[model samples]
Target: MLTFVAAVSTGFPAQAQNDRATTTVDYTVRVNDTLYDLASYYLTDPGCWTVLKKLNRVADPKHLQPNSTLRIPLALLKQSLLAARAIAVSGSVERTLGQGPFLPLNFDAALTEGDHVRTGPNSFATIQLSDGSHVTLHANTTILIKHLRATVLNGIVDRQFELNQGEVETKVTPLKPQDRYNIISPSVIAGVRGTEFRVVYGDGAGAGNTAVEVLEGKVAAQGPNAPPVLVPQQFGVISDSAGNVGAPIQMLPAPSLAEPGQVQKGLQIVFEIAAMPEARAYRATIATDAGFLHIVNEIRAESPRALFDDMPSGSYFVRLSAIDRNGIEGLSQIYSFRRARPSEASAAATRTANFEFRWTEDAHAGAGAGAQQTYRFVLATNSQLHDPMLDQTALAGTRLVLSDLKPGKYFWSVAAAVSPNNGESHEKPASIRSFTVGQ
Candidate 1:
């Protein structure tokens, strides 16, 4: 006996898919659906039913239950797998084609060979290659896509990027072992195979210097005159402005977070790293990204701990690296933490159009207790708070007022703070409260 059931949540796009490197579609099986029907509907070819059935390991196409999710492979869609696009872009980002002037880079911009991309101060961009690899550009960085092409028959991609300045983090896909991927700087070249690494160009005190930090796999860094240096996992190498490559150096071991344990309730991020025997001094950088491209604050500590104060409340990634006595910075260890101030929503009256919003105080708890905290509040008509009607920050008082808001539904949220300065700190907002003005 066969039964057809349509769950409430079973509705989905007939052909919808996430924009991953893989070219595929996520389709939900409808009542009395079969592999042939899906293949014909999506691929326009019922002959692909066997391919779809084999891909999903379904022996009996007649037994497919309703509301079951299936991944429809796109092998029949030629040229779909060969795509070069930007997955995400934040802040002011620009791109140029050939000798043309730079234009604002769109989030769905399709990248190709010879395309030049740059990020403004405090901005970042992420690019996806044909082979599902990713390259994240740091702020104030410029990169040229030297080569991006793949053979349809072999699925071998050749991707090369030239970093004119600043930093870039790369995550290369390991699917194709024979694929060629390289990051070229002014002074050196770093080549990789299915790994994660970071390259910084002209970052050192000296000009035209390049640094390669390998986080996962081995990276071969070469200078013009020096022999190629292989940087294995947790190791790094530096090239001087003169294109002289230095020997590989061990990265600093990751330190366990001591302060702020799991969470903190202040704008100040108290960073305490577990001691390391080889670490003389530590450098800490807090950013909104795991790649540390969007850096907010940086501090240096003679010991294993550093303090970042006066930052607004928010989520941030703290990156720490050990500096040997020789002044060489080792590999980095990244940790994510939240510096938030909690605020409670105040009661509202509908008699008058005036509304006063109040929230709880910032109670700095966990290792560093008794620290004075601050407050920031936001009032919006939407939950996402795109363009808030009332956005106030650095407010010492726990209350806010809107004199003449029209009669409608409104949402409000508040955040605690430790300082007036808005660093890269991400203060998670308290749960939002809704209120009505006039009927």
Candidate 2:
């Protein structure tokens, strides 16, 4: 094996100390593998052979035993640069490539290292890394892509992001040895191998405060003033701008929605979560897809109710989360629902004629006029309709008339059920009406 003469006589550089402080990867020595060859192939600088010799305590730099392992500090390793693709971008998201001007972060925007991203108020953006990991940026946030690199020979990756401000939610893919996934905030650094977590840096209202919440796997949280601490699942940590990181605290549990309707058939869509013990506010988001890859709307509510009035009729998923006093969001729960809206129907009873009870609706109530429309009617002596005196289904007409009646108050309701040509069932919300029948 050829030897690096300069590496043998030279002293290690001061950078070696910084490199030693970083994570390390193990490389098994192969036939004809020397410190010189290993440094040339796997390291940024081939002349760092002497540093490798000192790190591995090698007796012979020119001849390395086959199958022996050598530890290489990650800081000294060489890696190829990569990019992240913007899969879903909405509202007022913008991006900057290097020193270039900021452009709108449209669909499938490719961002590389040194790029920066900022989201405006009431906006959102989601980017996917080369390894299938995802990072979602909420409104009013700024972040810099510090590093996005990979080493092919050792199959290790290094992905790091510097959070300037605001919040980011991440779903990191499982990591291997020497694989680093870190999000550095102003006050703290959160490092994880594989997890679903959230890191918020000076979330608008809570300036100078950095919070990390782990939903899955574990994270190593480090601050300037404290040693690294392990934060397990359903846990979080808070770090202040003063560089002090607090102990991990148990995160809030998922909140249950207050018995949401199985199928919403109204002009508006609404969700009300059951009040949680320590919740100060609630956040609800809606998406067309189950994975939430494309979010359509999001709202924050001080009260339990969250209303969304402009969504069209379709199947969707709703994710709910609670915020604590410190403005930290908790674990979330997703629920499925169907919205069938634009229901318009009216009911009335004529006293003169044969006690006619009639109702009318627009010809195209969700399903167009060409679709087959059916009506279902229920009548009872009680308001609750516990025991119906008249129960009718699959009737063709909108009006229902009863000939002779006793002197008593009665309650009834009717709904238009449209069977669309596309085979989707559409139900116009029913309206109950009351009238007195005289003998």
Once superposed on the true structure, which residue ranges of model 2 sit more than 4 Å away at CA? 1-25, 34-37, 49-65, 68-73, 262-268, 339-439
- As a TM-score, model 1 comes out at 0.52
Residue-by-residue lDDT tens digits, candidate 1, 82-154: 4567766777899996678999998768878878999997677777664436788877899998867554433
- Residue 330's lDDT within candidate 1 is 73
* lDDT measured at residue 103 in model 1 versus the true structure, 0 to 100: 97
Residue 329: error of model 2 in Å? 2.0
* Number of colliding residue pairs in model 2: 0
The lDDT per prediction is 0.62, 0.70
Each candidate's TM vs. the true structure?
A: 0.52, 0.67
